[model samples]
Target: MTSEKRSIAVRFFGGAGNYTTVLEECCTHILTSDPTEAALVEWVKSNTKATSTDGIRDRLRFLEALELLEIEPERVRLTETGITWVSQTDPNVLFEQLDATVYGFETALEALQNGPKTDAELGDSIANTHAEVNWNDPSGPAQHRGWLQSLGYVERSDGLNSLTDSGRALARRRTSDSPNFQRQTYYTQADLEKAFDTSFGSYIKGINPRTDDHGELSYIIVKAREDGPYSDELDGERFTYIGEGVPSKGDQTLTGANKALLEQAEGASVPVYFFYQPADRSDLRYEGLVSVADVRYVSADERDRRVYEFTMERLDLEHPTEFETLAASVTAGEREETDSDANDGTNAGSEPEPALTAAEDEYTEVQRRVRSSAFAKRVKSAYDFRCAICDRSRESPAGTVDIEAAHIYPKQENGRDFIRNGLALCRLHHWAFDTGWLAVSDAYRILVADRPELEGYEEFSRLEGAQITVPPAEDEQPHATFLAAHRELHGFESV
Candidate 1:
């Protein structure tokens, strides 16, 4: 086992003067809540950190290495190996594991056997005891003192580290068993507010993105339902998210939320965390950390105007579409109900509006945009993501489906968002149908306008009477009312 010790400079373990109490408390916190990165940072700032926000995460990773907790893309949680120690009256099981893993454990014991040593001397005695791996006080001696104190093997007085009675026995015999050591409970939320030095209540948005006062992007929430106002589409490994803006009111310009996400594509180091809100619950699930892969200004087929679309690449989250039953944290329970202003577009709440100039107008438009997205998704799914006109289906290597949902009677004409009023078409046919070049008959057959002189007519005319592929559910099929209205509006002869 000693031969398998990490060959790197990880001579010491733990982070920023971490203690056994800190590790045990954090592991226990993971037992009841999803330990999202944001929450964990907040926790460290309050409980640790006399100076800055540097080593908080390292402490969490320390807990991970201790086999007391596990970290995922979205959140951290307690491990079953941790389950035994968190509830045990004595933490020697974990301390013994630490004694086995961390170097310099016996060196400190052996040195203190002679007499008490000053903190500096004790630190020196422990440093570089192992071959080629060295560490500073915070990662090395400070952490060593902390765990030693936790195990009741050491005590400190006036800047000195000395073995206790147990420590002396352990020092003399080089072995000791600890008495029962009761630990205190951890308050994750109270700790969070205190650490970040801010008051936080429940957020009232469906999607919330957190940016600091300095305008740094922290994380985003992706809330999905089978049919919802916005289409945050998950295709293969790529996530195509509609930028926050309502398209029905006018053209979507990339400003507010759209701009922030677009900027993420530029910096690879910028970590954009993702949280998933299950439609049926108020609590959110951590999807994982993601980075922006691509952003586009699109002339959307459904909206008939340009809107920003953000494509995101998952870093470590593989099964976002599948959720495991993980515990919810303070971040989840504190969420309030309301969603007009959920962040520039990670869909939003809690942060100051960066695009305040257009706040009122934009909020009003968000509702319409969400509705339009839901309609398109419903229509597209009903047709199994295939183009009805030519019966062609295609998906990009990037996992993007090429089919689009089209409105038969037209949004400009105030057509309602009903299943019968929509059709799934490829981009070519979608444009052709919208421009009056083609129509769908009440008999569900393809109809092309009398344009023998039209380009591509030779191939298109052959499909004149071909039946349209439709949804299996009768309720989802195209309605005769909308089809007849579309035929008449486009100058198609009655069938």
Candidate 2:
């Protein structure tokens, strides 16, 4: 196929790797509750840092193209086929669907069927087949290679290209009518359990049989430190955590295991299963198959040693029980049931408990504590307990740092208690952010509002137009909408 055709196909069909995020978002929103297009867009913008509606529209269109979504004039919902696709535990089936649906994929496969060919040879073959347009450009064949590799159909070794067993099978069974078309056996959960054998040990011990390129086991054990410098918690379809870099004896550098873990995570092409163990117990509470969503390198101490911070999205499962409990606590008032009280015999005619002023106060306090604690944990972990505005932090005696989580939009305004709505700031910067003196831009540049009283203050003046310390993932950074709201609230112009 020609490059123009390929480009058009990509625009219509969506890029190979790009579909996963949007698909996950769709499944998440649909499963949570049916949401309108506007609600989906808003949720994505707030949670995923999506800047425009076009990306969302294109994804929705792609889903419709693939027959995964049933789009009506006013609403869109998943089709039965789409629901099955999302619910499947096997990744191979998802790969097969992509290979079968992507535009120009079949033609590219046909070209590679005869024999192993270099990328240039494949491009030349495709170019010769279509004389109407140029396919000789690097991007033309590179796009094909990318799709094929992402679908697990092809591999490259020593600069030579070859088809995997699945690729060979796909090539031979090109026609949809063929019995073997897009068919392959996959490992079942029972099979994995049998092979790994967790009866006498933990899930971590069970999955340790497989090893990866980093000379470590295929899976990494993440201990959820809900109360410290390195912690982890789940938020909807994603799990956020601080990367491991606890100081080793006699040296302040990162641990060797952590270094290897970071390298593998950073370079991984496949999803890695993370077995999450709670702080109080050593046994595994839950396991999530995740891909690294974000990573940031931050200074570990005064010695200038650096460590990685991670944000991971769960690709294979729903939220665990612990996450559900925490989520329940944060949104308490909305879901609390008063039916029992209303049906009680003694309280039926007794003024309906009169709002229980003290109880209401206590409930509000509990909500704030739960929401703030979770929000603070995520924000502090994201920035490695360093201030975004001033880049200062001190270790507390309890192993926690002195940084605070400051909300860009206050809770009274119906702002969500999410990572995007928070920033890790030192005590001084937190005060400045709460007041009108300091604000941040969507671009993450520190904007100091024109304050006549602080004209001679070097500490405040030096930060004007300075870039704040942001998370590695674009989506985890402070959202532009929240930043805009903060700026407007503080009467600050764009810097």
- In terms of lDDT, the best-performing candidate is 1
Pairs that collide, model 1? 202-334, 203-336, 204-338, 207-347, 207-348, 229-370, 257-344, 342-348, 343-348
lDDT of model 1 at position 448: 84
- Candidate 2 residue lDDT tens string, 1-495: 112223222322234434454555566576566777777667767766457788867756656656567666556687766777778623345445444554345666787777777777777776776656554566666666755665557777765567765566556545422111011233333434563343324333312324445854544434353344444566666655655545453222334544444443423322245554445654344455444555456665676655555666654323222222333444343223234323444644652221111132443432344455456666777988799887889754323355777777766565655666778898788888888778887678887767657643566777888999988975457766678787888898754
Name every residue pair that clashes in candidate 2: none
In order, the Cα lDDT scores of the candidates are 0.59, 0.56
Across 1-495, the per-residue lDDT of candidate 1 in tens digits comes to: 133342121212234234555656666667777778777777756765423444556655656666667778688777776888878735446655566666777778888887888756766776656645654545456656666776667878877878766566445444422111111222233443453344446542333455667877544444333344566776555688776666456666545455556545532323344545445654444455555666666777765676667777665423221111000111121121112223334534443222111223322232333334455767887887799887788854323457877888887776754556789999889998999878888789889888899787887788788899999997678767678778888888876
In the order shown, the candidates' Cα RMSDs to the true structure are 24.2, 19.5
lDDT of 2 at 177: 26
